[model samples]
Target: MTPLLVAVDVGTTSARAGVLTRDGAVLARAEAPIEIRREGAERAEHKSENIWASVCRAVAEAIAKAGADTETIVGIAFDATCSLVVRAKDGAPLAVGSDGDPDWDTIVWLDHRALAEAEEARATGHRVLDFAGGALSPEMEIPKLMWLKRNLPKTWQRAGYMFDLADFLSWKACGSLERSQSTLTSKWSFLAHEAEGWPADFLTAMGLEDLRERASLPRHASPIGHPLGTLTAKAARELGLPKTVIVGTGMVDAHAGALGVLGAFANQPETIDRHLGLIAGTSSAVTALATEPRPAPGVWGPYFGAVLPGIWLSEGGQSASGAALDHIIRVHSSGAAPTPLMHAEIINRITQLRSQCDDLAPRLHVLPDFHGNRSPFANPKALGVISGMSLDASFDGLCKLYWRGAVAIALGVRQILETLNARGYAIDTLHVTGGHTRNPLLMELYADATGCTVHELPDADAMLLGTAMAAATGAGLYPSLADAATAMRHASVTREPDRSRRALYDRDYAVFLKMHAHRAEIEAML
Candidate 1:
């Protein structure tokens, strides 16, 4: 049996697997829905067992679909959201929320239960904050860890492992406790540019001085493409794959998608800095790499080795984009969220309505900070606002709102680009992947709204192929990730910005900034 590479991506809603040839051709892909428990506005959680089981099922299904024998799966790598996973010293899942359900061991990346803690951490004014866009968000690990220590003392005291979701998968696959450099540098506030990596003084200031020791973290992070070890026998048996499979250090899922999208430009520095990779889904991440560090205010990073070795990466995004669009549809007078059929109908409805007016949703505007502003304003307290809502509650009204919502999401992307550009990046092109690519309106708005040339990934599942590239690199099929990615990248379809729509979006962008300023005014008055 010839060896194959496997990529596993654990997203907010599902666990997906791709079995691919070494050259990056996807042979088979499968997905399994995982469980999430939302306990009000502040908390969201997932069962570790459910995630792991879903991942195993997905991998097995993919291998079966590919008709690849278990022994032929020679290399495996994982990428997942930056959720926090906690386990007891004996390896049992521990509760992360107030429900006290031990199975709910993962704090989802979008959870905002740590807002106060995040603000407190930001107040520390530590040097580490400089790397994290001069301020940190509730979404980061430190704030979440601080929240656990304060509110769930018993769980925190009993926990021995705190793995970022990606590292959790790698550990589950190979029994290696090493963390990924990408994960540590990007989310855990490890100062990758510094020789020491972990900022001990910063952690001490946050009262989590014992985190590294308690979590059993390695003194140094393993680079993204570094091989961890052969798959453990238990893991192999569970996955129904061969023990000979090599495992690689993993990264934040969006970063992996960025790697897949932008890796071809690795050697071309001038081209790389001008191209941003947008991986949008339940949320969105805009990633750009620079050979020289260029720290932008409110954008996370200038993070060294977060995306590629020796390249500094900066990330900016909306805390909610696709998710916000979904929420708009659900809460509209139209009632509950549309089923896939209904959503498609809504897209059709929007398209038809646009035919009626050259200026669809022209007066309507939305600030998509429903989940808090993750970047370009590092503020977690930001709330979403919708201007110019009419009293009409008909399906037509819903369509108008939906159209504006899509435009707003793209406008959010535009705002982020401005921040990046101001800080030294001249991004005139955006490579977009993920679920957002499925929405025709968003695809158009991204280019028209941002006035940037857009490239749609030819692969429907680029994240999976990206993790496959990592597996190939770790397996020594490619000398480095750059080599593997360049070899594996697919052709992209280009979309030039619509000059005709530019003026309309310019007015919308003005309203977008005004909304922020208006928000501040109201807050001060309150």
Candidate 2:
């Protein structure tokens, strides 16, 4: 029988599953939406029950679609958003809300209710903060945990398990409380390269001394792609897989996407550092691989062994790329709500608009930090800036706005690449995956604005494919993740930068930087 692996990607809005053979062929894929509840502008929550249910449904459907025998499914792997999942001692979901809604048991990655807590965490000036992008953001686990400890003491007292969503899924599947190095080092401030991994004194300084034991987190994190254990009978039945299936350690979804896109170059070892992974979805995560730790100011990482062992990863991205675009369309005078059809219509119109005009929104400029800057600046309070807008509320105006917004998002990438190149990375090639691939305009600007060769691989689900590679290794199909990555790397359709437009983008990038400086000046005055 042909060995197969199931890779599940639990994203912000959906749980997507793909079944693949050991040789990188995606047999079938399926997705199911996971509901998010937002009561306040800063509050976003998900029910772990709902997320796991979505995962199971998506996996079952994908397996059925593949028409593969369940016995042949030898391993499974998971990658999920860095959401914080709270559970009671007995394993029931613990409400993270004041209303005590069990359905709101998880705090989402983008939730900013912990903004004050993040600031407080940063104020501690602990050594752990150094690993956390030189400052902490509300998105990381520690701040969210601090928020729970301070605001919901009762919930905090009752909560026995605090799982990064990925670890939660892995534990649910294989009955292992082992966290992944990718999850721990990248988001939870567990330094994988360090001997003690856990910063006991740091947590104690924040009065979160019990967090380590509360999470039931092991002393050491499992390496990415390592098999933790076999799936429990209950999980096996729920996922429609065989009991023989081993479950591999999981990672953050974007990290997994990084693995998917950049892992292909792992065999090269020499030039992989020249490649960056731009995984865009509701939010964007810009992942850069490094053989050694080269920590730069304001970027989220230089995390050791976060994606691949013996390699460090630095992450920089816009907090609001897709969401910014969605907001642009929703609030525009000429636009209705943003639907798939409307988005496609805008994309189609922009194609024609660019044909007529050399630059669609040459005068229009956008600062796409609406949800705040997640990279090279690490300021969560950052706001979006629009330089050109008028009473022109025509549909054409909206398309132009969308076009400029897309370019600005790409320019944001340019700004990060500047910082990356300044630090040490010779990032000439960007391997892009996820939602940005679906937008032709964004894909084009990714190359033109950033002046990097864009590699868009087969449009297959790279996150799932990356997870599958891990699963394949865990199932004994390969000796290590490096070998699996080498075998499973999918070829890409390459797009080179339009060098002729370098002058245009250089000017735009200048304006982008000036705008950021201006915003900072105004904030300083206030």
Candidate 3:
């Protein structure tokens, strides 16, 4: 029988799984939705059990679809959002929020309930902050833990183990508490480069002195692709796989996508800095890898071995990209729901409008920070700004706003790219994957607005492909993660920037920056 691998990716709303061969060709793929309970604008929660169940379903369905026997699968790996999952000593769920329901045990990564805590962490100005873009983000684990401890004291007291969602999934699979270096270094403020990964002083300063003990975190983080042991009998039964299948250390979903696209250059580290990975979905993350640490303000990382071993990764992101576009459609009078068909209709209309007039909405401008700025500003408090709007509530008017909104999203990426370039990276190529790839308008803008060549991977899901590479390494199919990546890498369809539209976007970018200044000025007046 041919050896196969299962790669699971749990995102904000869904769990996806794929079955791939040793050479990285995906045989089958499946997805299952995981519920998110939203309490308010800033708070979101997930039941860890539900997420695991979703993963199991996805994996089982994927295996069945591929018509592969359970005995053929030799490896499994996971990638998830950096959500925090809490559990009691007896392995029961522990609530993470004000709600007393233990079932709501996971804090979603996009939860901003810890904004104050993040600001408090940023105020410390500790050396640890240097690795995290000189500011802490509420989206990271530390601040969220602080929020849990402060707001849910009873839950905090009951907490016995805490895990990054990816690590949590691994534990579920193999009953191991080992955490991934990718999750620790990138989100939990663990210094992968230091002798002591966890900074005690920083934890003490944040009143989380007992965090390591409370969370059951280990002194050392396992590198991505390290074998954590085979799945437990129970896990094997649940996932419809054999217990002999190895479970590999996982990573943040964006990092997994990074590996999928950029892993091809694992052996050619010298030119890796010229390429970047843009995992654009509900949000947008720009990942750049380099031989040495390249830290920049508002850009998270310089994380050692977060993705590839011995490589330093720098991540800059927009907190809302596709989400912002969805919000625009929802709020517009002519729009109903932001469904795929609706988005297609809007894009189709916008294209028609653009052909009629090169400048579709010349006056309309948007600063796409509706969910706060994550890159180049690091301001979670930052609010989106929009200028030039008329009382036109027609469908055409909605299309105009939507088109401009997409442009703003791309412009935000351009700003992040400029920041990365200034901070020792020579990135001129963007390897894009995820939901945004399906959006023609955003795909075009990603190249044209950023003046960078955008390479979209073929039909294979990059996130799953990246995790499959890790699984292939752990399964002993490859000597190293780099070898797995080099063997499994896929070719991409490239889009070059349209230079003729450069002057127009240049003007828009100027307006985008000016809008930022103006928003700041207006906020300062308050």
Candidate 4:
């Protein structure tokens, strides 16, 4: 029987699973929604059990759809958002939010409740920040932990184990306490290239001196594709797979997507910096890998071995992309739920309008920092700005705003690209995969606005494919992660930038930068 691998990806609102052959062709896929409990604007929580249950549902459904015998499923792996999962020593969930519900034990990655804590961490001036874009983000694990310790003292006292969401999933799979190098290095400030991954003095400075022991973190992190062990009987039964299935180390979701798209260039280390991976969905993450550490302020990384071993990875992104579009629709007078049909209609109208005119909303400008700016500026408190609005409350008005929003999103990617290039990367190609691929307007803008070749893998879900590559290595189907990647990677359809649109986008980009300065000036006065 041919060996198959199961890959699970847990995002903010759902868990997706895919069953793939050893060669990287996905045989089946499934999805299940997970709940997010939001308290006001700055806090979000997830139930660990609910997330695991969703994962189990998606995995079982995918295997059933694939019609593969349980015996043929030899490996499983996971990738998830960099949310923090807290638990008791006995492995039961512990509440992390104010609701006091034990089920809501995980902090969502976008939660900014730790903004103050993140600032405190930045104030320490520790060497750990050297790898972290010269500052700390509330989205990272340390600040979130600090927030929990300072605000929920009772929960902190009861905490015995903490894991990055991906590590938590791996532990649930095979009952292993091991953590992935990707998760630790990218989200938890673990310096993979150093003798000591975790700096004791730095944690001490941040008032997290006992964090390692409290979280049960291992001194050494397991590299990506390293097999933790076979699935536990309980996990195997729940997932409808055999206990012999190997459980591979997990990764952050964006990192997994990076591996999926950039894995083909793994052997071409000298020119890897010429390519970037844009895993854009609810948010947009631009991932670039280089042969050496190339640190840039406000760009997260130079994370060693976060994706490929011995390669440094840097990430910069907009905290809101698709989500910003959804918000624009939701707030508009002629809009509803921002469903697929609705978005398609808007895009169709915009396309028609652009055919007749040079631009749909030429005067309208948008700064899509509604959720906050994650890159270039690294300002989490930043607010979105929309210029040139009128009393137009018709459907066309909504379409105009939506079109400008998409343009802003693409412009943000261009800014991030410029920053990366300035810091030593020569990225000229963008390998894009995610929900944004479905939007025709965004797809066209990605290439034209950014002036880079955008390669879209239409046949593959890069996140799932990347996780499957890790599973293949863990199952011994390949000798190394790079080998698995090279074998299973998909061909791409390239979209070259339209040179005619260069002058238009250049003018808009100039306005985009000016809007940033104006927003800063207005905020300073307040």
Judging by TM-score against the true structure, name the best candidate.
4
Residues 1-526 of candidate 2: C-alpha lDDT, one tens digit per residue: 8898999999889999999999899999999999998877888999998899999999999989999898889989999989999998889888898898877999999898888888887888887776777887788898899889889988888887889999999999988998989999987889888899889888888788999777777899888899999989999888888888999888998888889888887877778789988888778889988887777778887888888888889888888999999999999998888887889999998889888988667788999899788878888788999998888999999999999999899998888888888888999999888887888888899999998999987466789988998898889899999899889988788999999999988999889899999999999999
TM-score for candidate 1, residues paired by index? 0.94
Regions of candidate 2 where Cα sits further than 4 Å from its true position: none
Task: List the candidates' TM-scores in order.
Answer: 0.94, 0.96, 0.96, 0.97
Give lDDT per model, in order.
0.87, 0.88, 0.92, 0.92
Of candidate 4, the 10-residue stretch with the lowest lDDT total is 353-362
**Candidate 1, superposed: residue stretches over 4 Å from native:** 97-101, 334-336
Q: For residues 268-363, what per-residue lDDT tens digits would candidate 1 score against the true structure?
A: 866689999998887888899988888998888878888788889898888889888889888998846656666778899888887888798788
Indicate whether candidate 2 or candidate 4 has the larger lDDT.
4
Residues 254-278 of candidate 3 have per-residue lDDT tens digits of 8998899899999999999999899
Backbone clashes under 3 angstroms, per model? 0, 0, 0, 0
lDDT of 3: 0.92
Worst 10 residues of 1 by lDDT: 335-344
Pick the winner on TM-score between candidates 1 and 3.
3
| TM-score attained by model 3 | 0.96
Could you tell me the C-alpha RMSD of candidate 1 in Å?
2.1
